[model samples]
Target: MTEDFVNGAAVQALLDRASGLDAEGGDGRLKAIVRELAEAVMRTIVRHDVSESEFWAAIQYFQEGAAEFGLIVPGVGLEHFMDLLMDARDAEAGRTGGTPRTIEGPLYVAGAPLVEGDVNLSDDPDDTGTLYMSGVIRGPGGEPVEGAILHVWHANSQGWYSHFDPTGEQTPFNNRRRIRIGSDGRYSFHSKMPNGYSVPPGGATDRLMRALGRHGNRPAHVHFFVEAPGYRTLTTQINFGDDPFAADDFAFATREGLLPVPNRQGDAATIVFDFELQKAGASTEEGFSLRARAAV
Candidate 1:
């Protein structure tokens, strides 16, 4: 049908029933959200006049690529949009000044070995190109933030993460560490340089990107979660400015302040960055979302 039919009383009644609008013993907020979502999808179907075969094919694609949905979320910009939404809210709340938060891709693992000071995260002999990164955590007023913990993880030279690598060559917790900031609020780590990577060739993300005339590639970067007591937890990452995909990240994670230029000498490189964190207004801001994360 058309937009008129999709918005008619008959469809509204069906949606209300489907979303359990009048049903008791269910979440009222969830029912309202589901009804709105159903209405939006129905409008989209009518707007595009999508064929039954096309709709079923799309559903099948999602079912087959369930494993890659995490990547697909960032690939299509939903993840980045979430960051932007939070940023807007923070601005509205008058929170300002700090390292800009960015998308936290679905690769973070919890419980890396904690170190008191500078540490080496790369232990795999197969990894190449030494990297030395140091940074300080400061409060919003530019004072040192002691007792901060920096959780860091990155891919290897071949763009394979430790636990998720399919080749089974990387050791557990390879290129991952939990560094405790010194009393001076400084933290440092050594690791092999990470390489940029593209979406799995011919996979769901790649297929969808190609269909939309886009490339699915992300620049070489390191992920981090910096947190301290009484301070808002910061989720951010640094992309290598020299990488070709640094500015063209398919995940839209390339922020102006996040691209740090690496100073190289021979095969070794160094980067120095600093972070500022606002005071937490509530307990909820002191930790990250309790999303399911990998361990070990």
Candidate 2:
């Protein structure tokens, strides 16, 4: 039998005992993390007088949130938070100066078809005006990095990704392709500008956003995964400057210097954005996603 706890400190003590929070006694890392979280929750409960029903309701909300991990992580700005943490680490390690890093929203699929030079990113014959994006990939010192591969993908005119949308299963990887830079370090592609995407309706993410009085709409953008030998891999996206939702991205992944202004050329448009890569360390693998290290 245990004494009934009425005070905050007593409540914390009870949690410690129940969760094996004593550092010298509890050995597992996961156990320690859970104990710390439990202690914090206990304090919050005491401070806010949270009722048992409210606590359980919050748990259920998280359970629902888990079903749509992709939408929630970006909608709630966790993906952007991860990028901020990486920027801080890079500053600390004196590893600065490269194209701004952005979040790779959980929609990337590996093994898109590879092509030499440029490949058409949009296959729909009914697509709107063509967008021709051309740029050079250079190293830290502005020298061309030959043979760099740029994996490019984006939503369709209807703001739906290829593999994820049921209607697109026939031509999965539509609007997705990889272009290898030539000796001139230049790569270009033709595609229709992708429309902005909103969180899927009737999902948990949409429900939460509605309850919070927020819109879950991202700006028009294109994703790129740039990789080359002896250079750090980059996963980022570029936002269209003229997009109405550019300043109000739900994912909060937009950054300065990454927005591109379009130049209309008669029937088509062009956007030029150069990418600079950082040299990799001796043991760093080619095309390593920095997010892997941020978790550690």
TM-score each candidate: 0.98, 0.86
Model 1 ranges with Cα > 4 A deviation: none
Q: For candidate 1, lDDT tens digit of each residue in 1-296?
A: 66998878899999989999978779999999999999998899889998899999999999999989889999999999999999899899888789999988988888888887679998788547898999789998889998999999999999899999999998989999899887899988898888889889999999999999999999999999999999999999999998899999999999989999999999888999999898999989999987678887
Q: Each model's C-alpha lDDT?
A: 0.91, 0.81
In terms of TM-score, which candidate is strongest?
Answer: 1
Clashes of each: 0, 0
Global lDDT for candidate 2? Answer: 0.81
Give the root-mean-square deviation of each candidate in angstroms. 1.0, 4.4
Pairs of residues clashing in candidate 1: none
